[model samples]
Target: MADLWDGALIDAAIWHARTGDVARQFRYRALYAALPVDALEAAHLPLRPDRPGLWRLRRQDYGARDGSSLTDFIRSQLAPVGLSHCQITLVTMPCGLLHGFNPVSFWLARDDAGLRAVLAEVSNTFGESHLYLCRHPDKRVIAPGDRLSGEKLFHVSPFLPREGYYVFRFDPGPGRFGAWVDWFGKDGDLRLQTSMIGKARALTASALRRAALRHAFQPLRVTGLIHWQAVKLLLRGVRYRKKPPQLEIRRSEATAERSDV
Candidate 1:
């Protein structure tokens, strides 16, 4: 993977059946990049903290600290899983000046053996964040179409209950990236399904500019869409659940069960 990748587009959708069978979907283009921490600090990218341009990426918006390197932060998070040496690549939507909203972002950790582990950062509209550590049970490299399950510990949406499990599937590749997350009820029945699929391209100034021109207010649009969907769900008579206390970190049941991996 290259240090930077632009022109990546995402087509995402969600389906829910808790309240009168409500569903909402949207499609938007976004830029994806894999910036090594050292390179990100030294390189001259167009990302700014508070400014309006084609596309801007702020370092403080991710990881744990305001000015800390993301690579180091993610490395520490993966240490408990026996993953020491690996390359971290972030797959997320860039923060635009109008507004920045990332429902979820993936941090792919690759080592000599292949994909060692994945750090999934989930954010809610209330500005709370949670992390989910996913890895294979056999300590082998994770391959495409592999499924990993984790318990739900954080509150994200009002329409969905807090108690349940999430089944995650990924199909990461050199040319395309795809992921699917299914929320299962306590009875082991499917309740909600969400997915993201996109293609990859080299990250360059021109590519960023083009993407920005095409989707200038993507961040704002995303925020609006989220709230709009929530309203739709409410109007449909879905029971609203209050947000629960936030959990800083959560590990998959499989990872927590086995200490060797």
Candidate 2:
């Protein structure tokens, strides 16, 4: 199938950029931490194809308690109330200046209040995870003659499609931005490994062992909202149930599985 830009992709990136909750921040940090340095640097800009300059970016590994560096960076970005990152989305233009730039057509706004919030939220999230903040610079901004600065960094959201909580969406992948699921659970939790770390290449299918107990109890009913809230509460409550998280077996054992495309 031919690759194309449906609104969903942009929506995913936007959603990730906007919602910067605690879970989101942790997940984002995990995903970033999980990425190899080479892969991380592979991320480039998504500038308009027709633009004159070549949009490139270099993402450095963010190493802070949670997102301390990110927070400081964002705070610096917001210092100029009249000059926020979202207000002016920065891109690296190696070729040259982009003449006749149409902010409207490009959907690049001067006052992306929502985007700014997301940026801050992402910073907040990264800080909490104690994961280091990676350096992400706008290639265009650093180009010899290009304008020195504007908002260049962005956030990535983690969410798995099935059997997990729905966190914000972010541009975790390079080609298509969308939701990513933070699939961390107990160390031996297969679900956790499959989702977050990577899928099992040799998931041995064990025949269902007949347990002494066989009767199935009726599934309890709960409202979606209430169920979600309860799930969240339990997740938080169980976090400290055991001290020291065990290293992931599946992630290390299975070897990295990623999109070849």
The per-prediction CA RMSD against the true structure, in angstroms, equals: 4.2, 21.1
Q: Model 1, range 1-261, lDDT digits (tens) per residue? A: 422222233333333334124554545444454444444455544443324465666666777737566667887887777775777667777776577788888877777666767788888898877787778766687777677888888788988878777777776666677777777766676777777766556556676677778766777888887788788778877779988777655534423221111
Candidate 1 clash total?
Answer: 1
User: Which tens-of-lDDT digit does each residue in 1-261 have in candidate 2?
Assistant: 111111111211111111212332212111001111121233322222222322211222122224233224434534443334433222111112211110001111123122221221222112221111111232111111111111112222122211221121122222322222223222212232101221111101111011101101101111222245436646654331222222232110111122220
lDDT values for all models: 0.66, 0.21
Residue clash pairs of candidate 1: 47-57
* Model 1 CA deviation exceeding 4 Å by range: 1-38, 44-54, 248-261
lDDT of 1 at 141: 79
How much is the lDDT of residue 95 in candidate 2? 17
lDDT of 2 at 172: 23
Best by TM-score: 1
- The TM-scores of all predictions, comma-separated, are 0.83, 0.20
